[model samples]
Target: MDNTKLNDSDPYSIRGSHPILRGQWITLEFSIIIKTYYTDSTKVEYRDLENQRIQNIQGLEDILNSEEIQDSEKINVFTNRLATLKNRLDVLEDLLKTFYLDTSFLDHVKKVRKEIVNEKG
Candidate 1:
């Protein structure tokens, strides 16, 4: 894959999921994501996001523990920024989930869905 961001317009767009396929890629017309793991670049991006998320969480924890910030304004600033960082962390989580939608990630979800439907049936 090209050394670029994995956006909608990335190599996957042009390859049409070629790089994401499993087994004999050339022989298969289509492949499910459950049959594959995260690509090299995708894994790299995931790690980067994870690292950022950890750092942000640690910073927020530090701010909460700090005794000097008893004022509301500074507390509000930290809290607000913490909320934004939490949002970003959530997005990163969902991005990883998106990447693993076809793998065991969705399998467990599908199993639960099936159980729910069966109960209704």
Candidate 2:
């Protein structure tokens, strides 16, 4: 929320999604905790232009939702602009759903949502 803007040039990725498996020594059952973020470098290629745009829109949404930005003098202006961007991204996502087949893209979107909600930027 300072004068610095969020980094958008390089891909943003979640870095904590490795699964942890837990099992009772006496039992044959195990539970796996799947973290929301993924650290794999190979997955970056799966984010197409639409997916990148959605991630950017979500970043704006994150900025607007931040407590630090709440008292800025230009709050209303930013809120409106970010809201418009969110709506457009939502519509575009709806249209692109059928066209997005690879699971990696979906994973990328989910990671973005989680990171934005957690205020990573």
Instruction: Using TM-score, give the best candidate's number.
Output: 1
Regions of model 2 farther than 4 Å from truth: 1-74
Q: Compute the lDDT of residue 81 as modeled in candidate 2.
A: 73
TM-score for each candidate, following the candidate numbering: 0.40, 0.37
How big is the positional error of residue 112 in model 2, measured in Å on the Cα after superposition? 1.6
The lDDT for every candidate, in the order shown, is 0.47, 0.42
Quick one: best lDDT, which candidate? 1
Q: Tens digit of lDDT per residue, candidate 2, span 18-87?
A: 2221112111110000111233311222233445332244455557777767566667777777677556
Q: Cα lDDT for residue 48, model 1? A: 33
What does candidate 1's lDDT look like per residue over 1-121, in tens digits? 6433444355435444446642234222112221221121122222235553223444565777789799999899888886775575345445545554356645654564456347535
